[model samples]
Target: METLLPKLDSVFSTDCVIFGFQANELKILLIDRNEEPYKGWRALPGYIVGQDESIDDAAERILYELTGLRGLHMEQFHTFGDVDRHPQGRVITVAYYALIRIDGQQELKPVTNFARAAYWHPVKDLGKLPFDHQKIFETGFRKIRRRLSYQPIAFELLPEKFTLTQLQTLYEAILNRKLDKRNFRKKMLSYGFLKELDEKQKGVSYRAAKLYRFDRRKYNKIFQNDLSVEG
Candidate 1:
């Protein structure tokens, strides 16, 4: 006897919530959709996965194709599967997120006609996004905020050398609240991973502040030891 296979009615896709810190603001990458179902509206960089491709591969390929951003070590954070999420079909989207430093030197160029342009928008007041993306963004944002307490993820969003004030500002942006500078600085320095550099902020009208770099080696040693002991 032969068994019948179920007909597939749903589709899989991936959306990227790339957060960047620049000019003391926390921003997420968004693209201007050029296709219907909300053409010309800003939305997260996303696209449907190919039939033969793995979800991870599809995530990276779609992101680069739609936004020209590649090689980012993004992690799968959440999945959105609301029945009416997509107007075209039953599209369930897996969301990936990454924190990165925003460099003014690099320009966002969309390689695909699906998107007209790609750019960053402040996360705080990001207006309505199409295709249930606003909910997806909020979910990703909450995940990162929870991870920030135990992970050194914030360093990934900072420049090679950054002032302590800049670091504090980034924390405030993510947490969406002002932190007491005195206490924040003292606590961050206590971690012993921020190496104070013999450098200062340049080209600023205000008084320059000391620069610091995240000492990855030291952080690895400290956390690895803890994990080893626990294991």
Candidate 2:
């Protein structure tokens, strides 16, 4: 009998497009690459997957290793397998994206030498990225833009207690358009899942705004009824 092994040409990697909202701006996390094919260029945090690791586990490891953040709401959006996508050989990549709240407390320090540093770049200020990452990011961004219409993911990117204006700002940033204030408030309130809080925002130079919190219990109860009706 003879030993069998995988081909040297077959390689797989995972790339992440981590998105965050800060100062009313949509941003994506990029790392300064330390190794070649595209050394010194900024790119999505990514690397070759371990042979024994599952794709999901590999994504979690890669994201944490490059960004030092964990427990994110990561979702696999697409896979890039173009023959020339990688300069080294036949490398295929699985791409994932996550939306996180920028609380100003999280530190981003790459754990591996492959990346020198990690930073966030505003979505609108981005230029051409190294490798096929530009296309990978575009695909993930479009997926999130479309997913926003059907999912309540925007709530995940807001503070625990936020004003209606803050909520609207987040939605407008993701959708990339102005939403009518009156209609937006009406539709959001109609859901009956936002609990109006007694406190107002502090530290503002001008008039303070009342705060509201997302009531998960109310949302679950309301949507359960809708699902039951549809079922």
Candidate 3:
């Protein structure tokens, strides 16, 4: 007896929520769509996955195709499959998120025809995004906020040498609230992973603040000790 195979009718795609911190603002990368369904509208850098590629490979490829950005680490967070999420047909999108230090000199340009341009938009008052992307952004934002509590992910969004005020500002931007300065500073210093440099912020209108860098080696040792104790 022969068995019939089900038809492959559904399509799969990937979207990226890349976050960066600059000038005391938390921003996400967005692209201006050139194709139909939501033409001329800003949306997450996304595209359909190829039939011959894995989801992870597709995510990286599509992101580069749409925004000309590559090599930054990204992690899958959620899958959106609302049936009507896409205007054409049944499309399931896997969303990936990454935090990176923004380079003011680097220009964003789309290599594909699907997107007209790519730029960073402040996460606050983002207004509305097309194709259920608003909800997707909200979910990714919450995931990062939760991860910030346990992980040193916020450090990824800061420069190599940053002021303590800049670090606290990044935290408040992600947490969406102001933190007590003295308490926040004391708690962060207690971690013993921030290496205070003999330098100060330059070219600032306000008084210069002391610069600090994340000490990865110390952090790793501390993490290893905690694991050993748990074991």
What do the candidate models score in CA lDDT, each in turn? Answer: 0.88, 0.85, 0.88
> Which residue pairs does candidate 2 place in steric collision?
none
Kindly report which residue stretches of model 3 are placed more than 4 angstroms away from their true locations once superposed: 1-3, 104-106, 223-231
Candidate 2 per-residue C-alpha lDDT over 1-231 given as tens digits, one digit per residue, 9 for 90 to 100: 899987675688999998888887788999999999899999999999998999889999998898787777789899999999988888899999988887853699888888999988998888989889999999998887877766677877888889889888888887778888888888888778899999999999989999999888888777533211010
| Residue-wise C-alpha lDDT for candidate 3, range 1-231, written one tens digit per residue | 899999867699999999998778999999999999899999999999999999999999998889888887999999999989998988999999999989642568889999999988999969889999999999999999988877788889999999888988988898888888887888787778899999998998999999999998898877532211010
TM-score of each: 0.93, 0.89, 0.93
lDDT of 2 at 43: 95
Query: What does candidate 1's lDDT look like per residue over 1-231, in tens digits?
Result: 999999966689999999998788899999999999899999999999999999999999999998888888999998899888888778999999988888742578999999999998898879999989989999999998887877778888899999998888988898888888888888888777899998999999999999999999999877532211010
Off by over 4 Å in 2: 1-9, 224-231
TM-score of 2: 0.89
> Arrange candidates by TM-score, highest first: which order?
3, 1, 2
* C-alpha positional error of residue 231 in candidate 1 after TM-score superposition, expressed in Å: 29
**lDDT: the better of candidates 1 and 2:** 1
Output the lDDT of residue 30, model 1: 96
Q: 217 in model 1: Cα distance from truth in Å?
A: 0.8
RMSD of 2: 4.0
